[model samples]
Target: MTAPFPPSRPSPTTLIGGHVLVAGGLATGGLKYAADIEAEVVQVFVTNPRGWALTDGKPSEDTALRESPLPVFIHTPYLVNVGSPNAEVLEKSLGSIRHALRRGVEVGALGVVVHTGSSVTQSREDALRQIHDHLLPVLDEIPDDGPDLLLEPMAGQANMLCATVQDLGPYLETLEFHPRANVCLDTCHAFAAGHDLAAPGGVKAMMDALHAIAPGRLKLLHANDSKDPCGSGRDRHENIGAGLIGAAAFGELLGHPAAAGIPLCIETPGKVEGHRNDILLLKRLRDELA
Candidate 1:
């Protein structure tokens, strides 16, 4: 189906991708899936996404990923909530991030992306303090060659720390403006947070805000179409051109300077076939709009 909004003037510089599942119980299944969809970049979980357990990747799997030409990214497990109040959960969250960083190195990943989790039961102030106290040491220990720690802003569900572009300030400050810190802006999350990416000049305005916050820190884009409307605060993701944000918004995003030369991975529904089609659809929008 054609997108509801006007097709954006596209650019040939963007490299779109998908959140490929590690199919067939193979850690390299994500790479295979990316290849199947002709994706230039790929994102995957180095271990079970829902659990805290960190997998010791096999030599063969590590070797295969290193040999691949794709720009791979490792997403820290969902169980990580670095802002959690509970001591145990907080410790695990910190450990999980460190583990993801180490794993990213082993797999030759470009970055390790983690959500800016909510500050449940704590004020934003307190959460920022905790994040600083715990994560500062970890960031200090990062080698000069370690993959960047990219923060993915979430939909402004209650207590979300980095809901808008301006909200990233405290986190950046807390990291003492660490050079390795970067952003992974998600279209659906920004739309859900009421950024209006589908509206005229909306993408530019959003980029302006991000530029004001931290120039050149937008290292990745989660190119999702929100199933929910602007300001709905829902995290539902829909396929390309098939949701509230529409395909044109994605094209708009691709056209923005902030998105050039980075991986735009769709975290939409469906696996292999769905992701394959979505990748093709994005590429079509990019080329046709250009």
Candidate 2:
């Protein structure tokens, strides 16, 4: 088989990389896998992904990451749902984010990723209000140099606050456009949410919409090909270039003017080898696409 990557190193300025949640410890596993892929940017979970635990057990690992030149991002536990109407769940969600932000700071993360969670019981307005009520205090507490709180839009599931990129405007407005609030655009989720990344000029169109909503606030990119067709509303993540969205769509995405400096992290389904290949593929495309 041909090598996926040539000997050339990827540019750290673009910060394109992957989500490395390996079998062993997060602190070591994430960095090792990233190095293997020549990834400049990496996303990792500080604690268990499925649970509400906010503790980081490896201080040495965190210190290593904090001291490293690689920029790190932390994905909050899936259980964090600040939009929940349930008071207990709301409290837990707020606590989870609060803790995650602090951990991000300690680990020298550029940002902490949180999903734009669903609103089950209340109307969208009420849900936004609840989020505002709970999150404002948390934002108030964040130090100026703390990592940004990046909101990742979901696959347009029912009652999701930020179902589309445009939907982020209201949330940011509610937060009074706090400087620390930024965005993470997920390609698969964007496709599933009815943004046509596969169509011609679609990537540019999406960038235009995002720029209109919050100018220059897109801090992270979750680069993944979608498993299902567009508008499927599913969150399945396929590897780069192997899914319905295809390779050309990502080429267009990389070449777009608005995507110039944003960090691209592949959240595609993969082990270390798979991700390394994917990263190499993206790097090759980035060169040719540019």
Candidate 3:
């Protein structure tokens, strides 16, 4: 549209001028159509949502999946309750994450996105320790072929581990700072978590915090618009511009210095209109910023 985004100001660390990868592939055709549109990246769920479970698949697609020219990512199963207080649930959670990561690797995906989840019980410190204990060893076992672990922070509520960008530091620190582990900040969730990403300097503030906490581990952005107001802890995602955060903030985000080179995965609702409209809006804003 704008003659290939002329190299101008310090372009955002994010992969600039590119459309966000639509959120789901397994349950929707949007993923398939998106690929044909020349999208450079994509994010998808390899299993059932809302829990730590997986959907069955054919063996042949594994090679083609991994080899696809698109830079790909995997959304972990929702059922995998990493913070569950019950030992049985904890076991299931570990298995779920492991299986999900393995599936992502087999499919040739680059990363597996996990919620900066919280405790099913009220034990905050215990949950954090359990998380470090449960996750660290499993991470070490990941082969070179395994997909990267991209921890997406949740809204600050109750016993959440990654409410703020800085909170992830301790957990990550406990792990000895593995190279393949990183973060994916969701725009809506950040707002819901009480970070005003819409205000001037907010985006950069979060970026600075992320850098200070995780250093080079910031890898992706879940560019979602929130339905609820800032600080609400709700999980509703609205269409890009129509939402409370407003679409223009995406410009702030994409224009920020820290977003460089990472994919912005859109977890918005509505189909192609949902993603395409946001993509169009983002490109326009990006051009304006450019």
> Which candidate wins on lDDT?
2
Displacement of residue 88 (Cα, Å) in model 1 is 0.6
Error of 2 at 215 (Å): 0.5
- Candidate 2 structure quality by residue, lDDT tens digits, 121-193: 7898998888788887888888877999998999988888887788888989888898888899999999999
Predicted structure 3: lDDT: 0.71
Query: What is the TM-score of each predicted model, taking all chains together?
Result: 0.93, 0.93, 0.87
Clashing pairs in 2: none
How well does candidate 2 match the true structure, expressed as C-alpha RMSD?
6.2
Clashes within 3 Å, all models in order: 1, 0, 12
Model 1: how far residue 66 lies from native, Å: 1.1
Candidate scoring better on lDDT of 1 and 3:
1
Expressed as tens digits, the lDDT of each residue in 97-138 for candidate 1 is 999899888888888899988888988889899988888888
Q: Give the whole-model CA lDDT for all candidates, comma-separated.
A: 0.83, 0.83, 0.71
Off by over 4 Å in 1: 1-11, 25-27
**lDDT at residue 192 of model 3 (Cα atoms):** 91
User: Any runs in candidate 2 off by more than 4 Å, and if so which?
Assistant: 1-13
